[model samples]
Target: MNRSDATLFSGGHKGAEAEFGKLAEKFGINEVNFTFEGHDIERKVGLKILSPDELKKGDVSMDIVSARMGRNFSKVDTIRKVIQSIFHMVNSGYQVFVVGWILPDNTVKGGTGWGVELARLFNRPVFVYEQDRKAWFSWIDNTWVEVTPIISHKTFAGTGTRNLSEDAKNALEALFERSFSES
Candidate 1:
């Protein structure tokens, strides 16, 4: 049986967790690993940004991580940690997917935004589930192009759509295969 591993990137906010949970439920939990900063509580699988000593030094919970990520753009340390975690995941051959809200100002939340940017910079396959549009979009030529057929918000809210065209799925599978073979 052919299988693929994925890394999910989210904004790490209140609603974000629910979105991620819905996504995980939709796409079999075993198929993807969620990454938010250095925490992966469910799968217990992720890149380590802080050593045991660092974690032991102070309060380093998901709440703190979430707060730090909220200010990631201005916090060099937080930004660096987030970038490094993303780099590690990409380098380890995990397909990246994003799910979050796009703000009124046309900007995504910090960590999610950074993950999308990193995927673009590294030429990795990145898909974003637009909650409002109820469509899956991909970054192409510096813009978001819808990649899947339009679906209802209920469908989007339910088993998160993974029904890309056969050609698109094949292309993504090939990318994952190549990464695995290379590794």
Candidate 2:
């Protein structure tokens, strides 16, 4: 696929990043972006952690409310950065993939819910790996629908190599194939 068919893997820091990184590499996708915090901001095997400065450099197209708040940054800065980064990636023509743990409240952890919401809002295809449930879900009909059987969740701690179920891999691969072919 051409560079225009690059993919963006969005998730919070920790195990999700590692999982997404491995999946991107496994699929031979060279361009992927996501958000990271603290010491988890290092470069991964196949993904780039978008920095706050990078977000400021892009055409964010949002009114940053804290622009006049001096250098006293807050969660607003992080929120703006995340939103702008996702917007920039999509605007630059990247297909978005999401992976994260779903809370008991059914919300995604690590701020990944925003990515999923953005994908839905923009009518883009999204493949979500519900880590907590060990299920593969596809964004369809404006909702997440399980596309595969539930599997056992790995009990690994922190960010380490985690394997996605074969069904999840296949579904993601099919999504990528369909996206690249359309591009």
Best prediction by lDDT: 2
TM-score of each: 0.47, 0.52
- Quantify all predictions' global Cα lDDT against the true fold: 0.42, 0.47
| lDDT, candidate 2, 1-183, per-residue tens | 353334544332444445544544554545344554543443355345656666665433333323322122246655567556555444443344555655454444544554555555567555566655766566677456887422111110112113445554554455445544433
Clashing pairs in 1: none
Worst 10 residues of 2 by lDDT: 151-160
Q: In candidate 2, residue 174 scores what lDDT?
A: 56
Tens-digit lDDT string for candidate 1 (1-183)? 112233333222233333444343444322223234445343332223445334333323444444534543444555445444444444443345555544444344555555555566568665666665655577777677777422111111111222233443333333234433333
**Candidate 2, residue 36: how far the Cα is off, in Å:** 9.7
Candidate 2, after superposition: displacement of residue 176 in Å? Answer: 8.9
Q: Candidate 1: what lDDT?
A: 0.42
